[model samples]
Target: MTASPRTPSAAPKTDTTDATDTTEPAAGTGRKPPRRRKRAALLTMAAVVVAAGTSLAVTRPWNTDHDAVQSGPRDTTTKVERTSLSSGMKISGRLSYDAPTDVIAQGQGMITWLPAPGDTINAGGKLYETDGESVVMFTGGRPLWRELAAGVSNGPDVKQLERNLVVLGYAKGLGLTVDEKFTAATATAVKRWQKATGLTQTGRVPLGRVVMLPQRTVRVQEVPGKLGSAAAVNTVVKVSGTALVAIVQPGEDQLSQFGPGRQVTIRLNGGAEIPGKVRSMTPGSGGNGGDEGIQDKPTVTITLADQDAARTAGQSSVTVTLIGTTVDDALVVPVTALLALDGGGYGVEVVTDGTTRLVRVELGLIANAKVQVTGDIREGDTVVIPE
Candidate 1:
């Protein structure tokens, strides 16, 4: 025989009892009614802690059914204005070069010469001399890792060296083409360059004998190496780009509000404000990379359109305010002008020549305690608020 299906019963309802339960008053002594006690119990439920251990009773202020009061002739009002409304955040940043290049040593010799701080090193210029052999700067995007000579493997480094040689006036009549192959003509040009820089004329370019930098010119910031120190693959000097920039380290949350070409205002240490735009943004893991001094945060680079203004605020801590979410030609009013309508929205009391009427509005961004609104609002329209 088949069994009959059992009917499922409804789940029991749960009652969330209040923390301060209402109780009936005792008879006599003109005690308050249960309604007042229930109301008091509800208000007690909204008690707020004013300090560490003290509590105070609080009441709700948003009442939709409240009566609208009439304003006297002396009541003050605010006029709605049309302007740009924006919301954003401000962060602290440093004004410096846009990723300065650290010059590390690769030659194996004593540091006999070091460039002074604030010196400008250009292409074909001597960065430092090791054991009386000058390590000359060259224009290239690749770092020199191996010796470039005849019989070496063909690669892009050979072409880069050839380009440098051409600019150094060494590849005039050697009939050499700027390519990946290491040719005998390239060796001849190397010999000419060696002779010009007082290096031994070996017709070969040794690793660490030339410093290849991506930029043509670099302004030296500091010489970390002391004269007569052993030259190794260590940071000897720090060089920065000629152009200055403001770098801000923001997290992923703040990065979402940023992009390329956004306008920003930088407040300098000396209380000067300058305008700039977002140049670039690099996402990072906020890694310390074994450096305790540097906070591992994502970086944002900003470049000022006015170069002269940047010169005045060199290498200092500044406050960076990123402007985000801008609405142009917007009708705005004070936030106090908003009132809860009887049904379900917000409205502002529009005051014309001698009459006042509540006009419903569509709200937009709220900035600086002012709200952007639309719908039946015009510039110079007077709006009423609580006196």
Candidate 2:
């Protein structure tokens, strides 16, 4: 009995498996054991990884500390700057006179003489000759509608004539008062003017003897009348001011961007640039009958600051740049440095002492590839641009 008890047989073989076992079955056995616990553990690990990634993206842990240094190449970074930013658009334009007026020939006569193009006629100067008689220029706001005689009614036309006579030294010693009246003094001054200019010493100015213009001086641009042709009431010549201006026809949407006194730039054909300012804007007829449905545009007039510089270009095509919205003393950075944030905003990578951090910013005028930025940044702070 002692010998039998000495070697207690090993415990009977049992077909039980450990509850926490995860070992795969033997190869080629084709046995697919339940693996729910394994799958659940793997899913839990995946959820943790996803949560960490989300936190990293939203929180931007690298930029959490302001004092941290960022390492980046010096050439890939730019400094925040303070400067003036403006939005502008360039359009084709013509460099020519500011205001062009047609000189119409009144009464009937033979056009014996005509001023050549580019001829500058001043106040009281001869404009043309009809029937071998000089047609003089008069500086007045209104045209001479009737013959200037002693019995004519008092009006601004008489006052304009008196003023011209006074300016031209014809009213000297005549005690002429520049009022809206054709008195004896005015008639006497007219006679003096006529005698000095080789005209008949008539105390009245004939209707066809004078042409009124607003400007004191004008440059003749064209002569529609030919010598020896019979002159009927028609446009005899075209004239404009001596000063040059740039004319641009912009879209209707651009009307608000231009106005009187707004500064602009005029680029000449030779690549020279000059400063200018808007002088006036005229509502255009938009598309004409022959335009085939072209859009309507407004005509903008710009005056050059330097008339001498513009005269060098003469009547030629030019480039006009209109400055629209502008911001002064703006903190700016390269547009390429902006980063799209996760929660719908923009940010920039600010680098300081070899460390970089994300900085939230508010955007403003974007011009010439430079963006206006305002945030927790200084003018000299370095911002990294993605390579």
Candidate 3:
């Protein structure tokens, strides 16, 4: 049969050519155009060449060889022998304690003399009472004239302050009250005591606070209240001796890597290191109201595992080291051997064939200036140790 003659539809009528073009595709659109595989291959090859050239251009060494990696300082000294080691932490710490001494009042009152110089009081022993109010709230005990004393301390505040002075190793008599006057000696003692307790060194008792008891040896005999001073009830006194001392409060940073039954080294302020061990770690915060008036810092009390002859309670400072981190057979390197990088951990420059190579390292326990490292370097391999 003959097909009827068909005429093409009139050119699509549209307001805009762009719109008409969007409505339909061109003729021959049913079959895809021939693919230009060779052209694509050429473009891809050109891109790969450009990328490779760019990479070569940016690389530090144009012709990298083993020599480039060998340009660091060579090790003349034998590499430290390898030893068994595990990860641990190290820090600088000051020895401290939360002692069980009788918290004394600065008066010659009854409870002042209860605990003898060598007496071992209970952790919560009731040695003295701060009757009427907390020392932190003392307001010159209702006498406005006391302020005119020019930094003078008196009343219950005087007794409390004086008692603190005695406990701080001040030789002032148990009846030694600073009167309504502030003495130079009194001020000096107060400042020293403040420094030791990590308190502000203002001579006056800030809101009338108690000073920390002296380090082990020094003791507070008594806080002398002014004789016949018309003050609220009799003033209280404190007596603390320097015998049988132990560091009760060791800082959190100190105990971070240490565990129980570890040996400890105690280095007292102006004294030498005395061998000791981790006696026990008391878990609790002193609620001490810290150096600032916020809550007391959370603290751990670590007593001496071994006796420290050089210990002095209430001393200004001491250094402590916990023993658990010690590595008897660990591969240790000088800290100077490692160079700090942007990220955590350190790197060492290994000396090989009169050149240096940087080797990345993972650190283990740290003691003194030496650290344990795990890396490509092996035992007997010499590395540059910075002077």
lDDT of candidate 1 over 1-387, digit per residue (tens): 001112212233233221221334457835323211001121122121111112121112121222222334524589999999766667889888755887888879999999998898888889998998998988787798898899999999999999999987899988989999999899999999889889999998888899888888888888998899887988888888788898998765567655899888988887888898888888776567578766677789998765676778778898888765677898988766665443233557677766555555656666555667776668999977643
Candidate 3 to truth, TM: 0.37
**For candidate 2, what's the RMSD?**
19.6
Cα RMSD to native, each candidate?
12.8, 19.6, 24.3
Best lDDT among the predictions, by candidate number: 2
* Residue-wise C-alpha lDDT for candidate 2, range 124-243, written one tens digit per residue: 889999888899998988888889899999899899899999999999998999999999999999999999888999999988799999999999999998988877688888999999
Cα TM-score of candidate 1? 0.70
Clashes of 3: 36
lDDT of 3 by residue, 207-300 (tens): 2243233333333344443333322344443444433333434344444434565556666666666665555555545554545555443343
The superposed Cα distance between candidate 1 and the true structure at residue 324, in angstroms, equals 5.0
Question: What lDDT score goes with residue 316 in model 3?
Answer: 40
Lowest summed lDDT window (length 10), candidate 2: 1-10
- Where is model 3 more than 4 Å wrong at Cα? 1-224, 229-235, 240-243, 248-262, 277-295, 305-308, 311-316, 328-331, 334-349, 355-370, 373-387
